[model samples]
Target: MNEKLKKKSAKMTKKDGYKNIPSVDELMSMKQSGILIEKFGRKLVLYAARELQSIMRSNANTNTKDISSSINSLEEIVNKYVLKDKTIINGTGVIIHTNLGRVPLSSESIKSINSVNSSYTDLEFNINTGKRGERHKLLNAYLNILTGSEASYAVNNNASAIMLAIKDIVGKGEILISRGELVEIGGGFRIPEVIQASGAKLIEVGTTNKTYIRDYENAITKKTKAILKVHSSNFSLKGFTSMPTKKEISLLAKKHNIISIEDLGSGLLIDTKKMNLPNEPTIQDSIKSGIDIVTFSGDKLLGGPQAGIIIGREKLIHKISKNPMARAQRLDKSALSALTTTLKHYIEDEHLIKIPVWQMINMREKEIKKRVDAIIEEIPNNVRRVKGTSKIGGGTMPEAELPTWLLSIKIPNINTEELLKNLRDLPKPIIGRINDNNALIDIRTIPVEFDKYIIQSLNKLNKKYK
Candidate 1:
């Protein structure tokens, strides 16, 4: 160290070190600070510098090595806040991954969103009559044809759709639900809580494993207003489990003069069985079973934008639409546009080719193997092709797994966690899982266009870590 710097280090005490830390203004004067300011703007750069200063002040050794290093630390903090919602590559092979932004929009859907969002068409205005119109009407015809329902309405998400229906239909009345159907979806959102929040009494009937139609019928009374059937979309009950059929539940609800509502959490419009996946109930089948009101998610099996679709009898949907909560929970123009385009793909029998979720699900094992083999050949890392299974994630068909091929990578010097971290630290992060002390990358959920990024990230890691 230099003579003057050595003296400064020697004189630095705990309190002296705290005072020695650079001020936000002093740090902002440095050359590195200019780069950060240009990228994140002055206000954010100043905030990040102060945040770092606060963190250093709390520590006894607050004396930074140099101004350059302090600015670098500030850059790291600012990047974290700025790129909090940045897009990432999904190598985890979980199609419809909730954490990774469930159900990526198709090219058509993206074009539709960009087209409608860039300028203005007719969001709430009727172009033909030049009058103010309802936004939900845009999707009504598409949903009616897709689900064969008398009418349809959309909200922000499936939970909102259910809440609106329950609040409007069973106001202050009792709502009967099967004990097994009292489900807690992702994010700890429980069915009972929603019912209670909707200003209705939750009466859970039957046992957790067995809920017969008689159990629902016996629970009805003068206070009963609706019978709720929540699909176990995120979970499965295997052996010795029993529940009444949708038809039987619908019949019982009709016999009692109460509404029959089904929350088909992941609304499936196509036949999953044909894709070799486990048989999942479809929205069409639910409506066909005489369900009075059916609710589901638009982003799950529908492969659309995030939305809650409510479709059933016209009168019931109209009643729910008039509720004040409907205005608060309604979908915006961009989501409606994207959802409409996604629905058109299905109507044209092009979902398998046009939707990302279905494309990943329908991808052949041989095609995936070919891609994995090519990725292994491109990178210099010690990677090999291995057999793996991709899951249908986002609370739909939890137990189902699709056969896939993955690249298993092992670096000689780095551990699994460090290797994974390095991959995530790349410019475009690569998200993968570890198995048997090796990093596993499943390309099933990744787009073909992003394959180059995987190759580049792995090569960078091999050069640095190896």
Candidate 2:
């Protein structure tokens, strides 16, 4: 140590009523050829110094010789770490929060997934027929029962479903779509982009805000191969806007000898009208609309695994099944198992409540209020009910902000934004809103296990602020 630093260290220790302070080397083991020191010189020294500093800070003592041994022990335990894509709790109220994983599998579906994944009887092998059989057949009857469609098939996601159909059917031909329907989804997936990638020519019809049936009819040419209508699930055009319905588009496609495809972004298995959500066409309703092919997501409103399912006329599905890309987009045994189980829950309709996404979406105002009341019972007088908004996020209902009952806290220590950030940093993060300097927790999204943690967190925040 330098003369000045040495003197300062000694003086500080003396003032603190300490008898002595050991030299850095004295605290460490005797150097044996300094091999470890040569390998990790600064790291070893800094670690030992910090350990000594910790001892000094707490007025504790340690034989400094154990410093190198601790580092060696830590180094021995290190191993290669790999990142695996897996499940995470969605604290955000968007029932199908895309980024946090679109849906939570039902207990039954999870069991099916485990069973199929652990052992394999037939992903491609046909056990019954003892020949090469279609993998989609496993999920076909289940989907047909739910959607009233003649046939069904599934790919990895909705985008693949669209691509598989168009790439096989509309090859080397123009496909017509409305400009207003060419909306962008989360993570930059767009309609025009997908169409172009499928090797199909883009024929845009109608205006951005208003597209009529006549516009589609005008766009039709000998080169037109298909007609695509997309639901603007992320946005809505209100007042002075008109668009053609499925029937009109179907007629236009029929007259032109072209297939009509309706891509329902948030495809719901059961009606959520009782939950006060805007009514969108279900998979069954789409099939009944005279549409040639219907594509939708399994995760969004159906609350299942991530999949792109196509249900429609058996002829079109057969064509899609034969495509070269079908191999790439096909679902695995796990997906089939989970999705089949998820679709089966829709058979009785009443079992919808058993699904977490459905339950959260259908949570009534009275129920949310009850949860809020329970939360208030545990929290201090500092937190109270504040009128606020909740969202059906994940791009399903962009125009919808669920009227949520918020329990808010007014704290002085941390700013509202920082307080929310801190809550989000918890072990199982708590996500809430900040408005008018109050942190609002919409009881709608909080899981049952998190209730006690939320109470403890609120109390800690109150104590910190006080």
Candidate 3:
């Protein structure tokens, strides 16, 4: 260390700035700390106090040698810990945003989650028969009712579902997959890595841009146990790109007596073909086409909690269920409860407008404009409406765009970045896009329940930031 820095460090003592730091017992005695104690107990508060002391000592030169500043710093540290994992608004117009907790569950689903989590549930017991039963029975039943799959299973996420299936069906056997379909999903989850981790051999066929049915046929050997087709959900390859259809590959698998497994990553059950959106495979289509197994995500287009759903032939699903990894990667009671309610909505044909993801996708531009107009009417000074687009994020429908209307806010002297940052610091922070030197908030992604909140937030922003 530099001599001057060492001298500065040495100059700090208990009398200088260290004396200002509060004791854990002293801070806990305050009325504000009562709320924290009820929420996070005394141990955590003590831990926060120790962390504050460490930070205060490290910056002793800059820290004010006063009890009030130290108490303020302690309160700031406590508040930071309290709100570290709180939810925020997703005004960025990305539906199913992975970073912001993909696919906000419906009110019914949320209630189911709370119900199952708040009390004891029949999660693993069959009350009808008064016997031990499987946990995924209701979930599987809904998947079968909604997608016509003979059987189904629910795991923690799609990757674990794929891994469990491969480990059970094709362990130490060759899995024929297209070179183009070997994709890396969010958080560095690559198809090849998942396959290898499942103890299966990956045999890449065809080229990056194209893979014909003949490619799969040629790659098949005695060791090949499964033909894996992964939907490139997060990205699209345009221009001269080609891959074998699920039907064609399933037919080939049938002829060869090999398994055909398609990982329809973002599990869209709704027919969006009428919407002119880019084609995304559905579990129903793959299962109807004789695909042996289809796996997908519950959080993405399924509009459910984070889960990996496996639906396929009963024999294959039974085999997968027997694997030890099935228990290790199984969904908890709360997630299954939420997923069951979500699938019930889909099965009853009520999800077109009930599910948040579908509601956002099918939301009319006029509807968004109406909401935007309401916001602008409330805060008429600096906000105006403009045309914009929203994305079906969370690695699904990468090329699909929903026409949306956005609120273009112009606070007189506030720069775009600072304005956005300040909005993000609110009680329910607003996240928006910066376009043409203005902050744009898409109303399609914002729920109607938060309409007044958004309006009040913007008005408060106008006054506070200015």
Candidate 4:
């Protein structure tokens, strides 16, 4: 290979010298700071170091010292990439921000996680029978009570729930989905794509903007095994849109003896329709709507761990539970523990207000203004108050406008983008937006407790420029 054609190394070590690759202790103590993502930091450094040594092994004039230097440089590169990745941030006015990591678990959930993580206790053992037991048995009963389903189990996410369902029910047959309901999610998590992946044929029915009950009936044939209803969780179809309700689809599936499943992408437990959060059907409602199977995200609206809830007839759930794929996609004990804690909170009248995520979501404009005032009070006098926008994230209510307030600080000399990046680079990064040459900190998304920290961070940032 041409020397120049290869990626250039920033520097090379001397052929032989007093210095060699720094020990792990030396690397840890070095003033040089880069990134610090979980295990990736040390792991990548060693990985890169080994690869560099192999690459240099073939080249003439290669020496031990040069290899050491290559390792050091790779270590640095790994440091830069490994800093804690995009973590769960409760910003963006979205309680369940999918991109930022959905559903911050409750204190009780955290306790449960710690309890489970500390030791393994009957994850698959039946305590009463003194025999091997199903892992899903623990959570299935609670889920059944909430949804009134004959049986319930969980998978890793909403997509896997649908995938496992189709694999179990529609193998070697057609899975009918509404053309309009054929939807896409983050990372191209599409319904049609999932249907194709499930070893089943995609039978799309209905129109994008409008599809009648008759349209679905007309499309069904001997090959069809399942009817799919996917909620457009991320976006809304506005104006001149007509689609069959879940009730209608359920009835049709019943008459044809086809399994019906609604992938309630970001499913909720309680009805937030009263809050004017768009009417995404709840799991209970979907069950009542007469669907045989309902799949939903545990993390998105439930304010729990990231898992997929499958509620339906026990026979079907049993079939799905037995699938080899189910074993691969099952939630860990920690996730199950966290979910139980979160689900238990729903039994109270003020459950939504008590949980941090729901508490933030239900915060009123006046409440935000009060919190914004606290944030502004902590900041330097130059910061200005401005009205801003925050969305109900996790794709629940596309049209729901969260009334909010923002504190905008104009920093001279430094670029706004650079300033924002630096802020995010801080430990426990504070994420906000830049607008009108000001870094806007929308208080609606920020919790009241963060008021002091937000101000303290700004005070430090302002000093850097001064």
Alpha-carbon TM-score of each model against the true structure: 0.93, 0.79, 0.89, 0.84
Count of clashing residue pairs in every prediction: 0, 1, 0, 6
The sequence of per-residue lDDT tens digits that candidate 4 reaches over residues 139-257 is: 77678777788998887887898899998999989888878888887677777788888999998787899989898899999999988888887888889999988899999999999
TM match of model 1 to true structure? 0.93
Query: Clash pairs of candidate 4?
Result: 35-83, 36-83, 36-84, 37-82, 37-83, 37-84
Itemize residue pairs with steric clashes in candidate 1: none
Query: How many clashing residue pairs are found in candidate 2?
Result: 1
Candidate 2 lDDT by residue in tens digits, 1-466: 9999998876676545332444345444435314445655645554654465445546533334344444443333221122234433344455666766766778899998888778865767788779987666758988888888989889999999988888888997999998888888668989999999999998998898889899988888899999998988888778888899888888888888899988887776676677677776677777888898989888787878888998899998988988879878888888887888877787766555667777777777787887788888998668898666667776776766677687887777678888888786665667776677787777776666667788888888788778
Clash-forming residue pairs, model 3? none
Cα lDDT of model 4 overall? 0.76
Off by over 4 Å in 4: 1-75, 81-90, 126-134
Tens digits of per-residue lDDT for model 3 on 135-223?
78878888888789899999999999989998899999999999999899879878999999999999999999989999999989999
* Alpha carbon lDDT of each predicted model: 0.90, 0.76, 0.87, 0.76
